[model samples]
Target: MKKPSLTILGCHSSIPTDKFYPTAQILEMKGDSFLIDCGEGTQVQLRKAKIKFNKIAHIFISHLHGDHFFGLIGLLSTFHLLGREKSVNIYAPKGLKEIIDTHFKWSYTRLKYCIDHIELSSKKLEKIMENEKIEVYTIPLKHRIYTNGFLFKEKPSNRKLNMKEIKKIPDIKIVDYKNLKLGKDFMTKKGKIIPNYQLTFDPPKILSYAFCSDTSYHSPIIEHIKSVDLLYHESTFLKEEKNRAINTGHSTANEAACIAKKAKVKKLLLGHFSNRFPNIKAFEKEAKEIFFNVEASEPLKTYYLDY
Candidate 1:
């Protein structure tokens, strides 16, 4: 199966630079795209990347930080201007619903598409958004204020029906074929029960991606994010700024790398850089000392979350 590709829409920290934008990521799963954290100038970046705006069916906002959610209103309004009639669901923190309501109410901006809002907190890891092909869950992260990270995971499922195998079993009913895809035993009318494991092979283990933005140095999450295909943790500062990072409720690059290493994740992506450092290599250098698979994202460059 083809895996989802993740695009780094913006990778700068709280402060924006000419070389970087704030925190925004695009995860392309199946045939649709999911926008995570719509920072400032997101539409321009999307256009520059040549991604269709209409393909974005849902948006997930990490927190109330301006750098994380500043561009959402503009993006939604633009979708309306583009004559979009489908509802766009937004999963955000508790305060987000009021924020959007107040902003739109005062400005009196109506949307062409229905805006569906799903507020996420430090709740159970369950399906927040789902479709026929994919299921998305929320991973709780320790951050200043109320911030919850997102986990986009492909459901562990069965393989396509082997028609040749079924054709040999002329007594096999079509419903039995469907049952095989569901990993269920197929019982013929004459009590010929074919165990699902024998007739249908197990599909490959599902691939998963987890996004952790604006989080402090957290370790308990090792259980939640263990062995994920891809992990994007915020590297807000270098070790020298550990005090500043802790004071500001952020994590240094070394700290982020530590968590990633302990979690045993497949690939580690560090972003959300402070504008103080003119060079992002500082982050990569510090992180590489800890985790082998690390990449500091560049704006508009899509990284495939390979399995």
Candidate 2:
């Protein structure tokens, strides 16, 4: 089974201040890095976090809010300047291509790498793209605008052979073992097909990751984001400012925690804090009241989810 790693590039809500950047995150699947929400200073944050730029083959933007996508143009331009030749796919909402073209056309900078853009939305929780290793889809979110969240799920892999068991089974062809690992019964030259059940264990189920940003309190989200390995949800304010959060289409720490708890995620990461609160501890304290596994994130910090 492949273990996934996640890095928090920026988590503060409204603005980039004292020690925070904005709202960017990086997920490492196998060896591929998938970036979620490239807020301002994402590249710098990646550099500080020691994330390899080239490994970031895909970018999934949560919303068009400046705090989420403002740094995209710059990052694309930087890729060109740095001589990136591989193509990068970006899964984002509509008008992204237009905005990217506007920036490139205005700045008169050409990208050296090909960029494949997939338009996304909440209404359509469709699979944007997939490969042998990972599958990505959009999850509708209730942000202030036409926003959408993302769900990243790793594909199930072949089960490993129980070497000890295989050793005891004499005359079992390695080819038969390979077939069993692939869930196929293989017939030996003599005649009998080896049963997969006797030879190999079932590969573990696929693991999932979900991201929800700038959304107000909502319950349906728990259904879509159910039982994920990791969940990053926006917590722009504390319960004291719940009214303001509702008015602004943002979620408070307690609200975010509630969603996480309902989803039964392995871990709940709270971010996008309101600039009004310089004290980050308040958000953590408030969220812990509802979610036991909840925790605050720091910019450029990475966490590995191994199960």
- Candidate 2: regions farther than 4 A off: 184-197, 202-205
Candidate 1: segments with Cα more than 4 A from true spot: 123-127, 173-175, 185-198
For each of the candidates, the C-alpha root-mean-square deviation to the true structure, in angstroms, is 2.3, 2.0
| Tens digits of lDDT, candidate 1, 1-307 | 4568988889887766666799898998777789999999889899999999999999999889899999998898899889999898999988888988898889988877798899876555656888877888887777778777888888667666767777777788776677789878777778988777767766876788889888889887678888889999998899999999988888899998898899899998888888898688889999999998998877888888665
Clashing pairs in 1: none
Best model number under lDDT? 1
Per-candidate local distance difference test = 0.85, 0.84
Best candidate according to TM-score: 2
